[model samples]
Target: MTQATAPCCDANPDPRTLRGCCIGLSVATCLLFSGATTAADSFWSTIQLHGFAAQSVIKTSDNRFFGDSPDTSFDSTEIGVNASVRLDPKVLVAGQVLARRAGDMYDGTPSLDYALTDIALIASPERILGIRLGRVKNPLGLYNETRDVPFTRPGIFLPQVIYYDKVRNIVLSSDGAAVYGSLYNDLGEFSVTLVGGWPVLDDNVQWTYLGGDFPGTLRPNGSVWTGSLWYATVTEQLRFGLSGALASLRYAPHQNDILGPGQTDIVYGIASLQYSARRFTLSAEYGLEPVRWRRYGPLLPRQKVTSEGYYLQGTYRIRSNLELMACYEEGVADSDDRDGSEFAGVTGGLVPAHAMFSKIATVGLRWDPTPNLMLRAQYQWNQGTLVLSQLENPDFPRQREYWTLLALQVAFRF
Candidate 1:
């Protein structure tokens, strides 16, 4: 997906304004660096700096994955720099700045990904409790928190069924607070996290929900709430989690806009499980997302959709530095309208039926010649376009129901 400019939503910052904010971030980073060096030796010792960079090449036989991948595009890149400072034994501050370029999906713009203060109110050998304030990562299924990090993710690309790239920005992080606690016992470990915050309302989010050509702007109107509960065995070989979130937003039309005021409510839940051994790992996740839209003028009718998705993945370690993985993923835009006939009928057959569902099979390999350098290659067979980003696949009529994609990536971290 490539990032393109569009009319700003009511709560969206202007592109120019965001550029200026990036400049401010640059200055702040410099100051933080200077303070780390000039403050006290102890203070400097408490600060840590880390970063990662990655580039990928993608090619698709029928549809583009990132940019016009039909010709082998180098339109995927990710770079991030983060710093953390320990204010006290139980308090810490951390922030990350990221620049990501995904053909038509995201532009290589520097942005503050997360800046949060973590305070551990209770800490013990067997139990821990903490709160995170500010821009915090939303703990979705299993891999969301570290999804952006190549080193942390199980594969180069996560399963689109549960982690759809089209709405990544909306679910990635939130501006708010979270309370988390964990307990360790002889039998197993249990943890819980609850968060309430305002979701990031960006152009991509609007473009995903409303057609990019829509005249009105979509913005967040209310807070979002999310919670997760996780359990793992004492050896940490088996783990499972349940997570859910509720998000609300509204659309405000311009004076000349053809669309009327509209509101959207989304509720989703995910169940995840993973089993890890010395050389093999098996994982599976299932999700249900119900979305409601109301009052989009007379042009767009009210809608209620319950989408369902799931994935099963397995990985085998061939060597200390080599791993192989395969996954089967499926997603349906509406459980009741699996073929999209109802949606197409409602839209006067303007939308393709294939757009309502997607099934993908993927196989990939990862090699780490060095601890800080990683290489990955993957192939995907896709049967639908439900997870494709509208910004990337603007010409919906031209999209193919079946497509093949090949991707290769190199990543480095320090």
Candidate 2:
């Protein structure tokens, strides 16, 4: 007997409506702060504002990324503003608003990135406990929380294998609460965070998983939970982290749609390590994501697939203003079917085997022209199309197994 496919969203709200809502929220927040007294002794003195803007140019030998990169596209831009205020010694509130455009993946829409209130339950020098309520950034791999900030990243682009942009929204942040704690001792310094909440689902997520803009819509149907543990030595030169999450979603089909309702469960874990010296830094991360699907319709089968990926990266500061970096990243859709031949065969060769995995070697240079300005240039040699966004490369048959990409970006922060 055949089963129905997963249920997904049939339609979404207008982009302008979403943008307007975010803008209104930001305006209200600003108004709230404006009502505070300007006196030096007032709580306004403890407020801080920060933001950044970046633009990138990308070119590709084959396949499109971030735009029509067949030639060169300047279709990538990121801008964000954030604020934080300390209500007291133990209470703080922080939030950020962002607008981004990246070809077909994102269309320069304003959104609420993160807004949370943090309370220190136990405050001490060596040990502290805290809880955060609101939309919080997910504590996953090393670079996930700060992925949008160019200054905090080693290169223009992070390793795509583990931090794939295709499914970024699913892991970026969540609307939930978290409890965190830290302990310091002679043995080591350790920190732990546990969070449970609902994930943000968007059209991009649906496109990434369903292969295109399906008639049905996909949304988070159940709760998602994540936890991370980190350790660092007394010297703070070496650090390690372990993170994991369980995410579930349901797809509801539109009336008259050919697809049936379905559900997906994803469990993933990541291990990360980093070593830093005065002018050199080395880091690596490995991740395993196992996905299970049920009642996915006749075209798709009910199956369990485990994806694995890893990356090794190093950065060296040649001078106070110049830095060089290199990295090797690899990802496989299924460890048991590394080549994807079986998948292609099962799908009647409609999907290429290269779609199952990706390997990338990259090198880049970063120049800090000033304290708040940065310029970067990078080159990548990629094998396979596993990590590329389907929205950008709609025609899979036109994609090449081997391709090269060059990117240049300018960023400013204040």
lDDT of each: 0.81, 0.81
- Candidate 2 lDDT over residue span 277-393, tens digit each: 999899999999988878869755687888999999999999988999999999998888888888778767767888888999999999999999999999999999888877677
> How do all models score by TM-score?
0.90, 0.91
lDDT of 1 by residue, 1-414 (tens): 011123333334534334323433454455456555555466657889999999999999977777889889898999999998865567667888889888877778777777777879999979999998777788999988877887888787889889987778667877778999999999789999998877766767777666554566677778888899999999989999999999988998978887789887888899999999999999999999988878887765688778899999999999989999999999998899887777777667557778888999999999999999999999999998888876677666778999999999999999
The clash count of every prediction, one per candidate, is 8, 19
RMSD of candidate 1 to the true fold?
4.3
Question: Ten-residue segment with the worst summed lDDT in candidate 2?
Answer: 1-10
Q: Pick the candidate with the highest TM-score.
A: 2
Query: For model 2, how many clashes?
Result: 19
